[model samples]
Target: MNPRRKKRLLFATVLIGGVAAVASLLLFALNSNLDLFYTPTEVVQGRNDGGAKPDVGQRIRVGGMVVEGSVERDPTSLKIAFQVADTGPAITVLYDGMLPDLFREGQGIVAQGTLVEPGVLEASEVLAKHDENYMPPEVAEAMGKEHKKMEYSEGQSGY
Candidate 1:
């Protein structure tokens, strides 16, 4: 092969390799930072579905209504615990930080953390709805499905 042709080919190969390497690195970084969102029902069902549950340390977001009368606080510290519930099931969460002012029972919330146990989440962050009519989109979608299921079951009972 001619000298010029050999040099051009080598340059092109190096350029392509560098691009691929950078792309792979970016994807790896994003994958590590990405947190998947699951409803409280989904989290519970996932644990009981007779399949492998999520890895204990994998980060995830759980969204649902804060179960009424489930909020407990440690007066000596910023620690708080609560349960988030959908129509399917509930998951207890432990958090050690100041909660958003809107956080309360019977309100929609999204907790980001990892599942430390089958039905427990160790939350690193807690987000609450901004207003009476506002809810996280994931929570809304999950609750909508729950509502439909309830309606269907009620309709079937008459038969």
Candidate 2:
């Protein structure tokens, strides 16, 4: 009611508003840049993150085992396509770059890119497991294992 009290209240309100605005901007920036990880089943069945599926044009990361015998490559170009599978189902990933040396059928890998379809991903980067004893934690978890090392015999397919 008093002038001095009124001025103090106004200053407090302004300061709180500025802080809230800055916080909102920071959250938006982080959310926009976030690339959520998903599995083949999650992609097809719809992810349950906050009860919303990933947008068709949203960028994401898919981690799983490279489906055995699912790799197809163009002879004249760097384009390649492969199926990645978890315990539930498989999703196709298309990439246009040199693959890592460790990349192969039954190998665990993570592809980062945009989801152009419900079951297809247009990958911009593909990362393979670095060593025989290591697999990505996300991939392992999706496959029902917790930090399990990858080991496959001949004629075995990645799950």
* Clashing residue pairs for model 1: none
Compose the digit string of candidate 1's lDDT tens values, residues 67-133: 8999999999999999999777789999999899999898889999988987899999999999877
Best by lDDT: 2
Clashes of each: 0, 0
Per-residue lDDT tens digits for candidate 2, residues 1-159, read 999999999999999999999999999999999999998888887765554667799999999989899999999999999999887779999999999999999988999999998889999999999998788988777667543556898999997
Worst 10 residues of 1 by lDDT: 146-155
Best by TM-score: 1
Q: Which regions in candidate 2 have their CA more than 4 angstroms from the true location?
A: 47-52, 145-159
> Which residue pairs in candidate 2 collide?
none
> Number of clashes in model 1?
0
